[model samples]
Target: MMSRLRITEIFYSLQGEARSVGWPTVFIRLTGCPLRCSYCDTTYAFQGGEWLSLDEILRQVASYDCRHVCVTGGEPLAQKACAELLTKLCDAGYAVSLETSGALDISVADTRVSRVMDLKTPSSGEVSKNDYTNIEHLQEQDQVKFVIADRADYDWSCAQVSEHDLTSRCEVLYSPVQGKLAPRQLADWILADHLPVRMQVQMHKLLWGDKPGH
Candidate 1:
């Protein structure tokens, strides 16, 4: 028999971030993570969760009758079976996206699923854990995100964008860490510097729900 995945929760909400932002999407929150990113909001998923089989997961997802699905986690890629799940979701015909920290190999994920990967910023404390090799795997449908918490993080992210030519590889996202960096300030920097990236403020702008999930 195949292994059951540890699931923190599954719920429906408008996607709070990324290109699929504002889409009514089912979020599959997998349990566990390896890195301790300082600004993580989903620390609740780090510990206890219920184990769920993929078939049951699909059944619950279909119950929602939504066309979009986002498989997220404390770190979704932390679970090896996540790839299998992604493929199953895609095969089932739901438009799927995977939100992951750029600390693991992304090549294993199904090509049909869009990947929204994060490159840890200095303030995240997991910057050094970033696997630069993953850059080469990014496709046009994919995205690279940098969660900025300070001016230093912004500057460092710009350098990474320039050094890697990230915009040409895929869409680059610059998101402010709520309460740490002001959204307007980040927007100004992007404009003044002429940074080729998308500036997203999910809570301030995109979120129709009271709070973000996963």
Candidate 2:
């Protein structure tokens, strides 16, 4: 039997986060994650998903007729087959991106896939899990995200950005943890610090109020 990947959810919707926010995109949320960040919103994706082969996933994605595809997870990189999935998507001629927690070795991922890596901040509790080596894997097309929950997290993220020179490597994004830090407060901090990183809100959360598979 051909091996298949465990998938938590797959749907077509507007890109609700990162630099691609608001763009029509297809989301492939894979199951399982090793880390449990304090403010994790998609904890539901941790378990209970159907398994599907790469070809089957592509067929389903093609039915959406959208060119932009985002393969995300509870940490999609945790599954070895995710790399294969990304390769297949690129071979199929779709603009693909992978949203991953920066805790994994991303150097093995296909170069054609833009990596949106999440660097956990101090407040996330999973901050120690960040594999700093992933920083070297970033390219201009890739992006780094820091979800800040408060002033401490924001400060830590700023330090990491400067220390890693992430702005030159890829687009840096700083987003406030919903209901934890006010968006306006985070915006003001970004401005005051003169940080080059882009400030973003969870656009889907604003629209759907934490609805799943959005």
Candidate 3:
């Protein structure tokens, strides 16, 4: 396992996505991702980043005095040290959560940390990268998110939810891609079908308007 991780940025922000939305949280955004999703906003994290040891990262997170810590990335699991970081954060008594692209093996993540895994839709252009096996590992505290861009994406996401009985396993979230799909339309569809999923928008975006490092 790596003792150090290439980090893009670490800052204090409200949890933007997932079940913990709006909670004050420390965000550790790691650098590098293997897939290129078209709607990707943090493309800056694809390349350069600073390296930090696990202890250094922990210290930085603790300095924020935040009880919730979210480990995110251009795919944080791309780095081997991420697994170690999550375990250490949990050991320190912080409520830890991981936001992964769902293309990597989440089986290595610390059990104490809640996982928010994404199932890439066809519009993301990285759909083929979705690792279906990760679904089996999702615990009750874990969640699945689908960033839907249009009707087609929403339909496909609904199918996956049924095929996997996603809600029965954990929380399932359906979020519309800003600008591509209207939030109201997505919400209507969800209500129309009675899909067992939570629909949310990026709260930070509403407050910060695409500001970097919020």
Per-residue alpha-carbon lDDT of model 3 for 23-69, expressed as tens digits? 99999999999989989989998999999999999999989999999
Q: What is the C-alpha RMSD of each candidate to the true structure, in Å?
A: 1.7, 0.9, 1.0
- Global lDDT of each candidate: 0.92, 0.92, 0.94
- The C-alpha stretches of model 3 lying farther than 4 A from their native spots are none
lDDT tens per residue, model 1, 102-164: 999999999998999999999999999999999999999999999999999999999999999
TM-score of 2: 0.98
* Model 2 alpha-carbon drift over 4 Å, by segment: none
TM-score of each: 0.96, 0.98, 0.98
- What does the lDDT read for residue 140 in candidate 1? 98
Find the 10 residues in a row with the least total lDDT in model 3.
1-10
Residue runs of model 1 more than 4 Å from their true location after superposition: 204-214
Better of 1 and 2 by TM-score: 2
